[model samples]
Target: MSRPLGIIIAVSLVFLVGILQGAMASTKTTVIAEKLAFPWSMAALPEGGFVVTLRGGQLIYVAPNGSKQPIELSLPDLYATAQAGLFEVLLAPDFASTRELVLSYACGSEAANNTCVVKGNLSAQAPYSVINTQNIFTALPKKAGAAHFGARMAWLADDTLLIALGDGFVHREQAQQLDNHLGKIVRIHRDGSTPDDNPYKHSQASQIFSYGHRNVQGLIYDEQRDAIWQHEHGPKGGDELNKIVAGGNYGWPIATYGIDYTGAKVSPFNQLPGVKAPLYTWTPSLAPAGLALYNGDLLVSHLVGRRLQRFRYSHDSWTLTDEYLSELGQRIRAVYTSPDNEVYVLTDSAEGQLIKVELP
Candidate 1:
């Protein structure tokens, strides 16, 4: 967990008004745990506090008093290297009653690995433990290398799950193919069964709901509007924020505004006949990491840009209304807006932090 550039610092244990000049109305960030080991995602526990994932296969509980306690768990050997490691943790819709949750992580060897989802029940106390864990679903055609697992998960209104899978960096072309699970968003029941109403129910990759995504780090289900919004990382430029539609083609390597990392062309066109265009795009690559809605406003966190941007959808478009936490100079990994609209962010680094932003 070496930080090449170094970690970003900010005012700790203090509250400030109007943290930014150009935009934000009133926002403040309070650093909770300042020494996390490269965490990926978080979810608020129904009882209290949070359950966070450390890339090296550790599930820890963060208390309301800002204390950190590592929870012991029995997990299979994980492909925890580079960008491949433990990812998103999502509590079930009936978490309060069942104490069950879903977690997405990379599983397998260096030469062959794929994204996997597991269901686990949690204990009620401080020395927390995950019990009776079961593998629910796994992405098909395991890929080589360690980049781009895109393991973000969200539960829809009907209690089905949506898992985002990335286009393995070298297998970008497979994004347009439907026979494999790479570069697609799939829908499944809690028990790992493909939903009968899935977009490709009869295809080889029967669980697929949408295809043509790069590495989707941010995903959310807007229950109010019954919509799914996701953001993915692009090559050099062409990062996108898209409103997902069922069975839609998002046009990745097939049609993109971004060129290759080597500056070669990825495609001849940026738009295709049957491909869906982005609701909004970030040129020069903002490196978006998470997405959530705070009081009906969309909040996107970034790694390269080191900021939290707020957008409001009105009049048929999403507009940037404000930005926060950029002055801290940290790579914001995940920003989760709780059910009550409370904001939480995880900075990316070996000595990163879990901070709560008080938004008014």
Candidate 2:
């Protein structure tokens, strides 16, 4: 049985307070390395190391030994308002041959802002030039202000791509509608075209894999269960971690566990029919933005409840057993596990940092 809502909130609050009392009491080793201006998403490289995106529209590479290098790319004019900027960075499925990378960011004229995806290959020469830049996707129903650019990309096993989008803040109703792309999880081919085997293959309006997502900040694939998981920020306290399913609707503005920023009720009930419940919900909002699963057993010691929270599966059936807190006070913006079982995380702040974790 699931825990009570009140208990979950109280326990989360107590955990936060306990961390405050013992701010310097370190359980796992944490190393705050070179800081980036506004690092957003993270992607592991083929040759060992990782690449991060900057909100200022730049790409920074982190070497194996903690050295920093910034790659030069042509940055478009971005609005850089609330929750918008260089949001997500993903490597092309054929990164080895293409050396291509893709990123989502907010861009538009002076009065309006729209999210767009750009794809390019990292140059083989000095400065690491981004060549053959192309705009693969752009938001519909464009409007002003930087908000709800739900743009995170993931590759499916069949080579089709999945993009998570937000329901442009002003159009909360659009989230439940099939005709619009806002507030939706879209499935498309790499060329930005809808696939034929999609849930609503015959209906253009139903390219949506799931709907009513407020602002999905995290998108990841679970190899173990063959399910896609997403987590996003809620209005005030109803942050959520979801197991995404095709053609399903996730209650957003209509049904929520959170309230308005002004303390008004967003919903009177927790579970509503037709709207799916989350696998895990974070009340009081962890502001969770990044997610990645730990796939190994060796380096599991140090990452317990710390940076890389693990959810282990039972033998007969998938039963959740362990839950620990990594006592890291900072908001986790992005998470990715390395090929060697090391964990990497980026904190959310102006002086945001990239930290690595391994078994002690």
In candidate 2, which residue ranges exceed 4 Å CA deviation?
1-32, 201-206, 296-308, 314-328
Alpha-carbon runs more than 4 Å astray in model 1:
1-26
lDDT of 1 by residue, 145-210 (tens): 998899999999989999999988899888889999899999999999988899889899999999
Q: Which is the leading candidate under TM-score? A: 1
- Global lDDT of each candidate: 0.88, 0.71
Candidate 1: residue 49 Cα off by (Å): 1.2
Candidate 1 clash total?
Answer: 0
Residues 1-360 of candidate 2 have per-residue lDDT tens digits of: 366988999899999887555433333445545578767887878875677887767788776676778877776666575677888888887987889888788878536667777788987543466788888777665776677888887888877778889877777788887777788888877777778777766654656778889988878776666778777778888877777889888998788888888999877867789888876666776566666767622111111123334444443223233322356655556776765666777766677778765432
Q: Which residue pairs of candidate 2 clash?
A: 166-183, 167-183, 305-324, 305-325, 305-326, 306-326
Pairs with backbone N, CA or C atoms under 3 Å apart (clashes), candidate 1 = none
Worst 10 residues of 1 by lDDT: 8-17
